[model samples]
Target: RFDMAGVGDSELVEGGLLYVERTRADVVASMDALSERVDSRRFLLMGLCTGAYNAFRAALIDDRVVGCILLDGYSYPSIRSQIEHYRKRVFQLKRWVDFTKRKLGIDTPSGSAVQGDLVVFENEVVSKERFAGELQSLIDRNVRLLLVYTGLGPLSFTYRRQLHDAFPKIALDDVATVHFYPAADHTFTLPGHRQRLLDDLDTWLADEFESETAARG
Candidate 1:
């Protein structure tokens, strides 16, 4: 699976994961380019974190995507809400840095312990950036997709409700299952959890593929 632009190894020239809108646009571009070469009708899209949001959005726009698997991500909300949340953490970090400089009379980094909390909160806001109007759009297209969100993170409750309301065919229990994870972190990179999650995914995917194959036969 290829990583989209401005992510992982594909960092932007400006540096840092600051511009989320640009990243979403890049994902869209990549999807459009990829669709040209393959049969859109058969392609299956899967992603983790922000990539999950991208895959869902791509499926909504391009009819070629037959299925999607999303892991540990938020649903669509206004970019404004995301931006405001992001700014709060950034300002906090900046305050800590400035306070240290003023008190110490020199520029020095704050204690690691304090920095850690800031990082967690920062991640919360960062996840929201990729959550554009994609989930709602996906339901509108009647896309067959599985969205996995953790019970442990800072997800928008409103958005989750919106997802359930949008897809009446998808019951609340199914939606609860879709956002499965032992922990509420972004990726659930914890030990053993990854494998367990993957195993569940493998079973679900096998079922889907088998059903498709049977229909074709």
Candidate 2:
């Protein structure tokens, strides 16, 4: 429930948004504080949006993190995703209207598929190759990863199989689980959506803990 520096109750710092190194340091500091107070050795990192990205980054470096729950973390559209996006758009009424207008030289599309506000970090981009490598490293360390995606715009993840497509070299079955909720918004604003998310989390956590216990014995 802790907020990163410059967010929520924490004091703002200079150059906070430009670099992720500070965020990662904050996560480690929080984990250290928790360890001093609790007897538990296992830790689970769960976050949404930017929080998700930080959690994932922390998990990669910290072996103490047993599991991670990421909600719409970091995703980039692969070539296949791009093709699928435009393919679906081709059938939509609005797309055709826009296309016709462009053909008639009446109107033109303004920008790329990716939105400007969606860009959170500056000068730090995680390539798909590096991401896959990090994912594999986490898997090798026996870290459990749960990726959850919502129906928010700029659909980087429209299908369950996109993860596999993005990291074709990695064997995800042994370590990763993915869930998609195409009807819900990014924040799960609706009561039903929230309930569904809770239920799913509960089920997954129970299963994950059981497996961890079995592995220990």
Local distance difference test values of all predictions, in order:
0.58, 0.79
- Once fitted onto the true fold, the runs of candidate 1 whose alpha carbons sit more than 4 angstroms away are 9-25, 28-40, 75-137, 154-177
| Model 1, CA-based lDDT | 0.58
Which lDDT tens digits does candidate 2 get at residues 26-123?
Answer: 88888899888985567899998778889999998888998999888877676687797778777879767777887898856574632342444323
Give candidate 1's error at residue 179 in angstroms. Answer: 3.7
Supply candidate 2's per-residue lDDT for 167: 70
- Model 1 has how many clashing residue pairs? 4
Clashes of each: 4, 0
Tens-place lDDT per residue, model 1, 61-112, is 6676767887754544345535655676677776677677868898555577
Lowest summed-lDDT stretch of 10 residues in model 2? 113-122
Global CA lDDT computed for model 2: 0.79
